[model samples]
Target chain A: MPIAITDPDDPRIEPYRAVRERDLVGRQHRFIAEGEVVLRVLLKQPRFEIESLLLAENRLDGLSDALEDLPPDVPVYTANRQVMDAIVGFPIHRGILAVARRAPLLPLEEFLTALPEDALVVGLVGLANHDNVGGIFRNAAAFGAQGVLLDHESCDPLYRKAIRVSVGGALVVPFTRAPSAEAMVQALQAASFEIIALSPAGSEILSRVKPARRTALLLGAEGPGLPRELLARSRTVSIPMSGGFDSLNVATTSGIALHHLTSQKDEKPLPR
Target chain B: MPIAITDPDDPRIEPYRAVRERDLVGRQHRFIAEGEVVLRVLLKQPRFEIESLLLAENRLDGLSDALEDLPPDVPVYTANRQVMDAIVGFPIHRGILAVARRAPLLPLEEFLTALPEDALVVGLVGLANHDNVGGIFRNAAAFGAQGVLLDHESCDPLYRKAIRVSVGGALVVPFTRAPSAEAMVQALQAASFEIIALSPAGSEILSRVKPARRTALLLGAEGPGLPRELLARSRTVSIPMSGGFDSLNVATTSGIALHHLTSQKDEKPLPR
Candidate 1:
């Protein structure tokens, strides 16, 4: 049986409400996502923990077949549009929103050490936009970046808009937060990483920069780009430009540069 | 001598009003821009043809110096946020809205034939988003993609959001719409251009694919990626995942990919 949540203050929907409370601990704040597309993709994982589900009165009728397979009793809630909006901070028109938990991250040391030799690591400098981060993560998944390394000043990857923009790449991509970009650059250098900062000024062509097979691409935010300190520590590689152009969004730049550097075509032909 | 017309129906503002009018000759719609950043950039152009200028009282003060530069007798309109919103059909808090005559595009044949033998081109395929279009144009300049070519389905490169997202790349980068992706792809092939389709499913990794010195990269919108038919006609290439990732946004991807192909990594030791 589904419960009706007519009021915004309903404690039964606490996980969903946590995101609405801005004063909640930064990391403690949680987010909720609804929609068949998002749910359908995420539900494929058997280990997924869904705290609760809110489906429309009519919408939940066909989902019984799906509900029977759930390992957890996800308390279902129903409401009219007004009631639903009251319960969540925003409108819940996407039909279904699940209060899924954010996974605890692995320690940076373990995340780095356990990664495979060919693992591609993405570290940010000062990416501020959640949408950009999420989009970057989405691109990372689409092009095959292993996981992300969040640096100081970067936006929370699990923020609602970020998750929505990333199409859940923020959830899927393995990541850990790093202290300072400068410190991370040094740590990566110590790990034998070719810390290449994507920039507009540098002459080292991004495609031609031979990362020692173990490359860690350092991306900056949209506007100011990587600080001098970060760039000074890393190999400065640039995408070539023609007339009337400037630079690209950091995430897009990351995707193409990563593809060019890591793909096999640019490398020596192996003996077949 | 900026004159304020009390009527939204004022004929003096017809060009400005028609900006929202549909199918006003697909090529001749009045262009509208709101906000200081876009207005500032557009003002820098010597060829900007103003229809009417609307400025919030504060913005009027901010733009007084630039406003004086406009030819005397150019019509000016003043309004507060409420009045501006009533006229614009949307809330525009930027306190500035400017209308201009659409700048005509350079003839495609003329543009193409004027190029040098080694001319670099930014060939776009089915890029549906105006923002992405503008952004790619911006990145094109930053990464050196020079002139841009758009497929038919692309939103007008000069669309409002496209111009905003491009940060004025539309004004700087020379772009023209191709009749079809097919015709353009053939023309590129005829030119001995190595037409590379950027895709996740590309058989050869981006790093491994040795593109011909003169190249055209075909990119489609996110999600759908490059079409299979288009892929059949061109060399399929992919950016290697940096972190076992998926793909980047079209503009970001283009920026990096173009950077790779265009960078001055000359003296690259010939492959063994």
Candidate 2:
């Protein structure tokens, strides 16, 4: 049964208070899932445990279907729009927010070993922007890429804005952060994954490169690109662009690269 | 000679004051170009006139080549970091900002008529988000699409943030706003361009479809997608995706769609 909460000061609702001051996800293992769309994605994933739900009274009716299936012990707290705003310290237009605890993170080596022999993966280096991280995960999920590997310099995928930008892809796609770009590359090489570094100066154009059975695309931060040593060690490729234009955004680059590498001959859509 | 101003409230710099309170771009025919990269692009574009440049004292030395080529009448203003922040109402971290006036927008019909016989173009419907609009233009430029036709409901591509997000592609690509999506579709058909409507429910897969000599992709806003009437009138195409995943971001969708449709058999980079 859904709980009716009238007080904005209710201790049970404390986790959601003043979200802008500091992200609850960073401070604790609990992360916020905003909007009905993200909450729905969270409901479907078993890896995360739903801590509770805080919903506007007006929004409850619209999300009855999602609420009905939630485990009985999971508390569904409802507040009027004003009280909800007061509790959260701002207007949350989405009106539906869920707090969920993150599952145990997989180590880089262990995660690499689990992939299938012909799996497609993306490796990100020095990608400090949260939105880019989330966008990459969303793209990864769309094309059925197995997982992503992030170096230490990358932003946390579970950051609140990243999760919202990805439409909850940060929750669905499997990812692990490594100590450094060098370490991440070494692990993939040991796992027998072909490393193709994407660079503006890369000799091979993206369209012409044929991926090996197990392939990992190496992407770097928007401006600096991949470190020279990394690019030199791997097979380097570039997206052919019209002359005089800057390179694509980091996330957009991943989408284009993944689309080419993951698309099969005869061009059939990958099964979920 | 560069004009040096130490006072934050100088009437000479009034056009740049309190940028966050009200965007000067929307208020007037003017827009802002931020950072070194965008400024460089703006310099190359003949259409947008550089009204004035506000550069931090530290940055002027590095931009010697750009400043050398500027017309003598165009004022180059230099300020210290603190004074620069006071003028723009923000940190102005990139240390480079320029004010540029938009060129007169071409009429929708006239712009469409101007494209080459074999040109590829993109038509956007009800895309109100500036980032998405900017991103689409960036992708369009990458593949050498001739121009974009936006409906009345779309945001202005010349809006300040859109230009910055586009990395100034909004300046480079020729675009015009039409009164309605239906009207835009008719114009493309009249111009003898094959219209391909991209939709999640599209019947034909994008990869298998061979584009005509003159092809224009019609894309709608993310959630509602293209109107059924528009879809019926045009040949619909879908990007094959892994099942259970939501459709890609509209911008990412454009990038993938344009990449596949625009790549030539010989795989040469599209000429600018």
Which candidate's lDDT is highest?
2
lDDT of 2 at B10: 92
DockQ of 2: 0.69
TM-score of chain B of each: 0.81, 0.94
Determine which window of 10 residues in candidate 1 chain A has minimal summed lDDT: A263-272
lDDT by residue (tens digit), candidate 1, A1-272: 67887776777876665355642355353456557645654565443467778776666777777776555567788777776666666766776777666667666766777776766778987888877898777876665666688887998877766767777667677788888887777777776677778888765866556556567888888678889888777788876555444546666776676666555423653333
Per-residue lDDT of A1-272 in model 2, one digit per residue for the tens? Answer: 67877899999999889887767337458788888878888898888899899998888889888776688899999998888999999998888888888887798999989988778889999998988998998898888888889999998887788888888788878888889999999999999989999999998988767788778999999889999999988999988777788558889989888888876423543343
Candidate 2 backbone collisions, by pair: none
Q: What is the lDDT of residue B225 in candidate 1?
A: 82
Give the per-residue lDDT digits (tens) of candidate 2, residues B219-270: 9999999999999999999877777886599998898888878775234433
- Against the true structure, whose DockQ is highest? 2
